[model samples]
Target: MTRLVVVGAGITGLAAAFEWRRRRPDDEIVVVEAGDRIGGKLDRIRLAGTWYDTGPEALLGRVPEAVGLVEALGWGDRLVAPATTQASVVLPEGRFPLPAGTVLGVPASADGLDGVLTPTGVARVRAEVELPPLSLPDGDVAVGGLLRERLGDEVVDRLVEPLLGGVYAGRADELSLAATMPALAAQVRGAGSVLEAAAAARDAGSRSRFDADGPVFVTVDAGIGALPAALVEAARAEVRLRTPAHGLRRTAGGFEVSVGTAAAPEVLTADAVILTAPATKAARLLGEVAPRAVDPLRGIPYASMAVVAIAFPVQDVPAGSGLLVPPVTGRLVKGVTVSSAKWPHLAGGEALLVRSSVGRFGDESQLQRSDEELAADVVADVAELLGLSRPEPLETRVARWGGGLPQYLVGHPERVAAARAAVGEVPGLAVAGAAYEGVGVPACIRDAHRAVDALA
Candidate 1:
């Protein structure tokens, strides 16, 4: 039987192990995680006598990988869609419903964006179709740079910035058009105008299997944090917690991995290895065997942020799913999610759960504040934005993720391709994680399967 060692037992690594077991059930698999727990960002905390997810609460149901995995694991019956996805954006005037017929806040026709954008802003977007025909250049370009030139600053600052910030925690001016919004980017290259491109992209989306009338996002009744443990049980791999892989080298048979503390190290020999660690850690391990992959892997930069989970009396909270705050507002809290309103399972509880995200790519100072201070500031912002009285929460918890998100800057796809090509040269080496491809759970799972397939 073949022996395989998987590094970093995050969702990506655990998903790799699961896929491997399906393909080769007889193989021996050992998963080593640097952390004490199996789940990395997908974690939970008890608040107001109920379990609340401190990290991502849901996955895009439109993506088949995560949903398919859920079904394969026999939890299909437990899958729950959000009760309400009608989110709003907090503008200087007040909160307004997120405009429809838009692809990531880029208006398709500028028809329903009256309150979201000023008269001048709407006029600017309307004039986009009348301007000269637009097309993307030969290479990657910043999402904001291209849109701002065609659609004006209001469109980017009010609409695109908040939406992209909620997803990437990075500025639109720095994010890549090709990497972040691939479909819209592709449409932009062929369409006559930005508005035309957005409309075409929206049309394509409406025809998708997971279109508007169906649920777009989903989570389990037990919470997304429970997925890791369920995955561990299903994979049945020998998992070693707090066992960090320090170095890797090629051996005659396969590869040898040095793990554990530097002072007292241990080695594990395996026929194949799947690296699911973050970009930096993966770069260090591939230094000797796959030196060509190291630079690109190390080039990926990360952003730090904190999630402040608070539980308040149901009546004290506002009546909305959530609100996205744009950076132009100069607010410390980037966005707020009303958990009780969004998830059906979390509803009908005495305490209304809410989560606020703080920090961005370049701004780490917000994360440096004390947990109590951060929580208080977020609470104040939420109360102010929702027009709530100065009410105290029943319970509060703060979870900080340093370098939690990878910035997909211009040329990210090329960098990932270069890294993959270099690692493919080695016989039994592959890499997969949030750094290389998409940051969502489904994307990570898809990439994990790709890595496993490479080895097979």
Candidate 2:
């Protein structure tokens, strides 16, 4: 039987292992993770006497990879759609509904963005079509730069920045348009203007599974953090937790992986190896066998953030699912999700749960504060944003993720392609993770299948 070694047990690595088992059931699969737990960022913690997701709380249901995986594992019945996906953006003036008919805050039409954007800003957006026909270069362009030129600073700051921050925790001016919003980017190239491109993209999205009537995001009743354990069990591979793979080198038969502490190292021989560690760790491991892949991998930067879950002993809270606060507001918390309002499973309890996210790409000073200080600050920010009466939290929990998000800066697509092409040159080597493609669960799963298919 052939042996496959999968380094890193995050969603991508575990998904890779699962895909391999599905294709080659008789093959031996080994998964090695440096962390004490199996799940990387996907994890759950007990807060206010209930299990709550500390990492990503939902999956994009429109994407088949994650939802399909749930179905394949016989957990289809456990899927849950949010009670209300409607969210508001908190501005210095007041809170307003997140404008609809937009792809990641880029308005398809300026109809719904009246209050969200200043009157001047709205006029600028309406004038976009009147501006000279817009065209993208042969290569990628920064998302913020393109929008600011065509629309204005107000649109980018008020609309796009908060949404992109919530997803990547990175600035729009630095993010890649092609990598972040490929659908809109594709339309931008051929469409007459950015507004026309956005309208086309939004229309196309409505025709797909992401239509308004259907659920765009989904989660399990048990919590999204539970997915990693379920995936590990389904794969049924030998998982070596807290076992770091320090070195990887090509061997005559296949490959040899040196893992564990330097003082007590052990080697595992496999016919194939899948490196799913973070970009930096992957770069270090592939230094010898896939030197060309190392630079591109290391070039990818990461952002750190923290999730503070708070339970207040009252049901009366904000009406919407959450509120997105742009950096322009100078709020300590970037966003706040009213857990009890969003998820049906989390409702009907005496306590109202709220999860607040803090920090961005280049800002970690907020994260450096002690857990108590950070949680307190977030709680205060949430109260102000939601117009709550400074309700004391019955219980509070803080979960910090350092270097958790990978930034897809300009030319990210080309960098990833180069890294993958270099790795593919080696017969039995492949790499897959959030750094290579989209950062969401579905993207990671999709890339895992791609890696497995490449090996096949």
Candidate 3:
């Protein structure tokens, strides 16, 4: 029997093992996780009689990989779409509804941006249509710089920064446009004017998935944690929790992995190995095995963050889904999700759950605070943003994710390719995780499938 070992029991690792088991039932499969739990960032907790995902709460259902996995796991019936998708941005004065028909805060013509942008900012975006033709950068360019030249600094600061922050926990000024927003870069390169390009692209998108009024995101009643739980259950693999892989060595037949403490270590041998650990740990584990890929793997930076879930009476909750705060505002909290409003299931009648995200690239000091301090700061920020009195929450829970989300910097694709090439040199070995590709659940699943297939 062919023996395969998968490290790090996160969604990516679970998906890899599950797919491999489905394709080869006769093979031996073992999954090892350093954490006590299976899910990595897909964590869920119960407080005040309701379930809340302290980590990633929903999956972009538009991706087939996510929806397909849900259906395949027989959890399709449990899937619930957001009741409200409307969100706002927190400004100096207060909250302003995000204007529609914009792709990642890049408006088509700045027509409906009265509350979101200042008069001068609106005029600057409108001027993009008449602005001179600009040549695109050859390889990679910062998203902020590109938009600032085409649109203006005010628009990029006020609009694009918060939107990109919500997704990448990164500022557009430092983020790579080609890696983060390829379509926008391509459109800007082809069209003479940025505004015209945005309009044309929006028009085309209106005829595609972007215009679909259906649910763009989906979650289950048990929370997104249910996804990894189900995948781990379905995978025909022997799971070892709290058992970290310390080292790996290549043998004549395949590979040998050292597990547990160095004092009394246990080594397991396998014909093939799939490492789904985070970038830092994966690099360390492969230091002795694949030195060539170490630099590229270590080059990928990770952003640390914390989530504060506060439960309040439904009466105190807002109507919209959530609100994103721009870094320029200098708020302790970056964003707040009206969990009760976004996922009706989370409401469950009695209490309204609201979760606030804190910290981003170069702003990780906030994450170092104690849970009590972090929660207090988040509550204060929430009250100020919503213009409500600071009322005591019924219950509060804090989840800290250090080095959670990976940063996809400029030339990230090339770096990932180099890492893969180095790993390919070692037979029957592969790496898969959010560090290499997209950070979404769907993307992790897709990456896992590719890793498993590579060995086959």
Error of 2 at 82 (Å): 0.8
* Deviation from native of the Cα of residue 344 in model 1, angstroms: 1.2
TM-score of each: 0.97, 0.98, 0.95
lDDT of 3 by residue, 320-399 (tens): 99898898788988788888888878766777678888888988887887898888888888876765554668888999
Q: Per-residue lDDT of 404-456 in model 1, one digit per residue for the tens? A: 89999988988899999999999988999998878888889999999999997
- Give the TM-score comparing model 3 with the true structure, all chains together: 0.95
Once fitted onto the true fold, the runs of candidate 1 whose alpha carbons sit more than 4 angstroms away are: 210-213, 316-318
Alpha-carbon runs more than 4 Å astray in model 3: 196-213
User: Taking the tens digit of each residue's C-alpha lDDT, what string does model 2 give over 217-283?
Assistant: 9999888888888888888899998899998989899999999888889999999999988899999
Residue 338 C-alpha lDDT in model 1: 90
CA-only RMSD, every prediction: 1.4, 1.3, 2.0
Instruction: Give the per-residue Cα lDDT of candidate 3 at 50.
Output: 68
Candidate 1 similarity to native, TM-score: 0.97
Candidate structures ordered by TM-score, highest first: 2, 1, 3
lDDT of 1 at 161: 92
